[model samples]
Target: MRPLRILLLLLLAFASMPLAASPAADTLAADSEARWVPFQLTTGNQIRFRALMDGRWVDAMLDTGLSDTAVSASFARAAGMKPLVQAHADAIGGAIPLAWTGLGRVEIGGLVRTGGRIAIITADPRATGPDAVDLFVGGDLLAGHALDIDYAARRFRLLPSGRMPFRGVTMPLRLAGSNNLYLTELAIGVRVQRGVIVDTGDGAMLTLTRSTWRNSGAQAGPVTSAVAYGAGGRVETDLVLLPDLRLGTLPPQTAELRIEGDTGFTARKGAAGRIGGGLLRRHRVLLDPRAGRMILAVNDAAWQPSRSTSGLMTAQDGRRLKVLHVMRGSPAAATGWTAGAEICAVDGAAIPSAYATSAVAGWSVGTPGRVVQLDLCDGNRRSLTLARFY
Candidate 1:
């Protein structure tokens, strides 16, 4: 949370109100209770949960990085919400305007908060359809409760304040500003960095600030480039494999580390990086702001880096499959394939057009050591054998 960019409209009397009338007070009055709610992992690797917003059922994401709860602008318009105040949020790439409105109530798995001010923002284009996420529940709304996410079971639970949901290793969660968000320490090969933000909204395993990554002493390895979309806009990113990452007393694990270029959101005061859902999915995570700790219980003992065998990441573009990234040292990269190259077909099968309802680009990650032929839009054909790049 930062200073306001502009004031579009205001209701002076209501402007002084808090988000939820002190969630801690409500938590203290209630006994220990837990309610399990199912969630879905979107294609982008985000946590999507079913929630009730103003009595209407909608999809929501549990995003600890956000300071306040928000609804998609389309959802706000459809629900006939009136904006009370206007502000701006500094996001991944830059600042984004926000319109504050009040939702009568927002509930997820029986954990309800009322009379809260919600920000109206735009949703990603890929997040559409009847089951798309229209709401994002942030730290401000869940400050009083504990969040228990069981990634293996694809479920989440909300516990009353002071309730330690699991008996597991814990790490200190430090408050970041007045946003109710937190940062925790992360050890990368014995070099401890204490400014890692616990961000469930992000899909990447770990993202480091350019300066932080440069000084991390990471071992040399194959590097890949990719694009990410967020609040400000699209941003180019570089990815690498990091070895020996330890969280609290957990065993060392290998994970993919993303390096944010200049203009990325990883730059925060005294912040080293952000840990997102990609790595958290391998463990049962408990976030207790009131307790000032985050607990982790390993569900998948064999945690490994998520890498492409073919070293290629493609996206649907018009009537062709656009090569968005090619991992250095990968089979695809060895062919000198760069970004913006279009493939008209894969293994002789025509690539799906942008308007096609089905995805037929499965050949992008075919069996390892198996040869897949790509027909380029330039009327040239190339073949490569799938193999682990990093």
Candidate 2:
């Protein structure tokens, strides 16, 4: 990862801390073992250990995209929680009613008691795929601690101060719009200025909101391309070029960004975008889902060579393709290909629309016999042969 990306990650982790402690008083200390407790979510997704709520420890999702801490209504009820009030939440699925419940006391590892509220919503624990987990803890819970998450080891550490020793650069969290926080020092043009959710599930580097782009000083190009998925899904966006954007304190560089118009029903009011595989693949990121904090470690050697080709490459449904962003001068753009072209197969293998660009990075770039065939919806099904970027 570059210095700017590292700064953005640090800022994200720092943003998770609560602005202030809840008025309710409760004291709970960290566990003696201090072992990272992984929590399973209803989505069958599991994240590193965060803090424990009450005697029944709660695992958190550590999502930056969320503005507050959230809990499943059924999980809260099952945990014997009675909320103080009902709050309405607009999720990716739709608007759902939730109950705001307070945990008497919550602890993590060896951390002390911190009083806080949890939003309870209805969720299907079984609905999460085989690898999905059930619970999610947003940024509201991580106000006071310095967090460290190590995915390679599946371990996490939480420190009480912001000055803890770490290998990455730390940056400030800049409030974008109403409830969004942007990591300042990242590459230019990349406007991940929304509250970010460190989601490994998502494939893109930055998921931008159409509103954010309109409000931003960044230059907006044309809606040169479109990406469609299996759920009758299609995203229409323009290629954005940010000249002097900042993530934190790190110097900014020119960056290629995507400006998505509407994410169907997935777009919400509070969050502007998401930081997913596109960013994570560039660094070693650790997330304390419970605490809602994260740490990003840049592997300069790993991605230094690929930095030049970052936005030039496209991945479709996990398959790397030479698809172009019709508007931008992408590799596919030079071939007279436009965006919204359906990438049917790579090397004759059928590719899914959900393919992540990072997954395709494993293949050597510019390797011959690496053909990318696509099926377009422009009335004429077209197939194009493309090369990988080294």
Candidate 3:
């Protein structure tokens, strides 16, 4: 009887004491520990952030498509990092030689990765700018980390592994070869496509293999031809729109997606395609590769379709604007504009030489039905009525 009485008294006393933290409280505490780091969206819509690499300040890009972290060859030489190994990697264009070296530390948003291998990437001579990317933070360092990107805020946060902040539809993430994260069960129209990669490095909304695009019963033509620059070299691609696309178990609102094409990368491992920043920017995304899961909360449900007015893909060559590709069925294609044709003036104004090194938008972009006149270096003049081709 005394033991029973003592037990009863103890239970009463414990019940009177304060209770421990609930699961909800624990989640809040964990979320509070996450620190937000601001990021900039480049003209190409790629995420760029300032990072400290081996105690040196550097501009870095978050690239999930890359198998390993990389530094520019120029940056490696300037930092005195000697290559320990030479290898080759397959890119969208082709296979390219790679040099691997040891990096002491890479810190971004106070998250540090130490003693990791980094590949050295050669810069393209055609891409000239003082603000070239110095480092690429790749999948090798992102594994086992919880990353939340709020595109509307232009900020991202790092939480403890297995901890996620945003709550929405959670999907399984497959960490495939080279630490690439692939999401499956993506429904484009009525057909379900599997093995879709999440590529933050790519600025396009989505990219499909040539075979995948044809198999989807999608209409041909009205595609804007352009040149995509990457690790190996430049590859010709066609940009189109994908309608009624839905991700795995996500919201039912069908998204109008801008899709590109690449023959090399998407065909590997039976991948259907890859989705990039153009689609991700509409949602608050949380990627937890360690737990093999991704969380997504749609921030914008309304679809904003891009209307290409100029239909001319041009690059600055020396002091002139060089035509890279003219979209078939576009105003430029209907004209005598050909690839390699250089432009001397636009709308009767001579282009300044500084435009060759500037980050300004090309003169080809403008409102629909806008009349644009161009003077070519070949002493030919042409007029184009800018309109939406697709």
Instruction: Please report the candidate that would top TM-score against the real structure.
Output: 1
The TM-score between candidate 1 and the true structure equals 0.84
Better of 1 and 2 by TM-score: 1
The per-prediction CA RMSD against the true structure, in angstroms, equals 7.0, 9.0, 15.8
Task: Provide TM-scores for the models.
Answer: 0.84, 0.53, 0.82
Compute the lDDT for candidate 2: 0.43
Residue-level lDDT for 320 in candidate 2: 32
- lDDT of every model, 2 decimals: 0.68, 0.43, 0.64
Candidate 1 C-alpha lDDT tens digits along 64-164? 77777788787788889877777676666455667787667777775777764678875444322224568887777776677888888898877865667
Clashing pairs for predicted structure model 1, backbone only: none
lDDT of 1 at 160: 68
Model 1 segments more than 4 A misplaced: 1-34, 123-131, 303-306, 317-320, 351-362, 377-380
Residue 158, candidate 3: alpha-carbon lDDT: 70
